[model samples]
Target: MPPSGGSPVEPPSGSEGGVMLSDVMGRDRSINLFAGFLRDIETAFRRLEDSSQNTTVLAPLNSAVEKLPRKPWEDPQDYGALGPNAYEGGEGRERAQQNLRKFVEAHMVPLSPWAEGEKVRPIGGDRELWWEERDGAKLIQPDAIEVVGIAGEVANGQVWIIKGVCHLT
Candidate 1:
């Protein structure tokens, strides 16, 4: 876990031998929307379980997810269709899954202890992201979402609770 001032709480004594990313997010109420989303995406969950690679999860707060202009699975191509259930059946189901995967992956950085200004390709997409500190807050960029604090420090990496949504598709 990060130092106490920038982290919600001190990491549990067993952090190094310890909790997984899923457990961390699942237990944190502030990021339940993202935690729920993580559960629904199996591949993303698998990535979280892969301790061989370092990963940092930039989970958006529930309020941040709620304030999004559109749901995570939505794409403008879906707008070409009629109803809200655009990603509901047949090929749409596959499309929905793909869209959802990208949304979750966008929040995941492939590196842990990610440097403050070093840009890196995300674990799942073409878009690269970096961090910037404006005043005292560390923000993920391209989107400039504010990272509120470290939610958990585990063996694999850290989970950051953020204040804004990332990719929509």
Candidate 2:
């Protein structure tokens, strides 16, 4: 387990001896959107688990999802005549999954024990994110979003539940 600004907590069970991303997000009840995102990328998470390098994930909670620009696939009407579940299989599913993978990757930085005042590039996007401490509160990409609560460590990395989705501008 990673330090949470204090003593380390016990790692959650079923984490393959490493802290899983789902376990970290599970601790925060408000991170439903991020949890869903993780579910959509189960394969990616598995790959992350297999890697030896440490990673840092910047996850957006429910409120952050609400603030983000809506994606066409998120709306049932956007599914056209095929229905919402149309994206569940076939080429559409592949494309949608690819997009989701990119979105999730954009929020992840390949570093562990990320510190304050560090500018890091995301794994899926070109823009750089910085860790900022304002008024004694820790924040990542202060110009883009706010950190909701304390950071938690998982088996391979740290998780920061952020308040808003970040976009590459």
Candidate 3:
């Protein structure tokens, strides 16, 4: 488990080692860090919309903003459709996809129905995810959106990094 700032808080003596203090803190920090990244992504989306130059990479970002089901909720297909067009070359496409995956993962909001008690799965399938709690707040980690060797990256005002990847069901 990663350190969660400041001095480490040693566990109380004589307690069962069911869960480590570091684990809990790491989860909490991961959630907060991801949330901050999501906030930045939302702003980036807005800037993409405001831009006038219509580039290939801008297309997917625009579509994502338009098709985002709701605030903090988005479908993975939106990123898939953008494909290589989201980036300039092979490397660019990979970066774009990585970025988009990061954006969605960071921004993914827990559905009330699912968050109530049930274990939530990824939109497409059983992709491993990270769950974190910070100050009693919960956060979900984003899944990797990739096709082959290409990864996604966030560039400029758009989530313009991707390769023709599929999220296996």
List TM-score per model, in order.
0.82, 0.71, 0.23
Number of the predicted model whose TM-score against the real structure is largest = 1
Evaluation by TM-score, superior candidate among 1 and 3: 1
Q: Write the per-residue lDDT of candidate 2 for residues 1-169, one digit (tens) a residue.
A: 1101222233334545556554665567787666556555655465455436677878788777777666512434436756666566465566566666767787788787787778888877788888887786666774647787755776677778887776644
For candidate 3, write residues 81-151 as lDDT tens digits.
Answer: 76534344564444544554444443222231222224454333354444344455433334332212101
Give the poorly placed runs of model 1, Cα more than 4 Å off: 1-17, 81-85
Error of 3 at 65 (Å): 26
lDDT of 1: 0.75
lDDT of each: 0.75, 0.64, 0.31
How do the residues 42-112 of candidate 1 rate in per-residue lDDT, one tens digit apiece?
A: 76776666656678998999999888877777777777774766766566666776777788888888888
Cα lDDT for residue 77, candidate 2: 43
Supply the global lDDT for candidate 3. Answer: 0.31
The candidate 1 region of ten consecutive residues with least summed lDDT is 1-10
By TM-score, the better pick of 1 and 2 is: 1
Pick by lDDT: which candidate is best?
A: 1
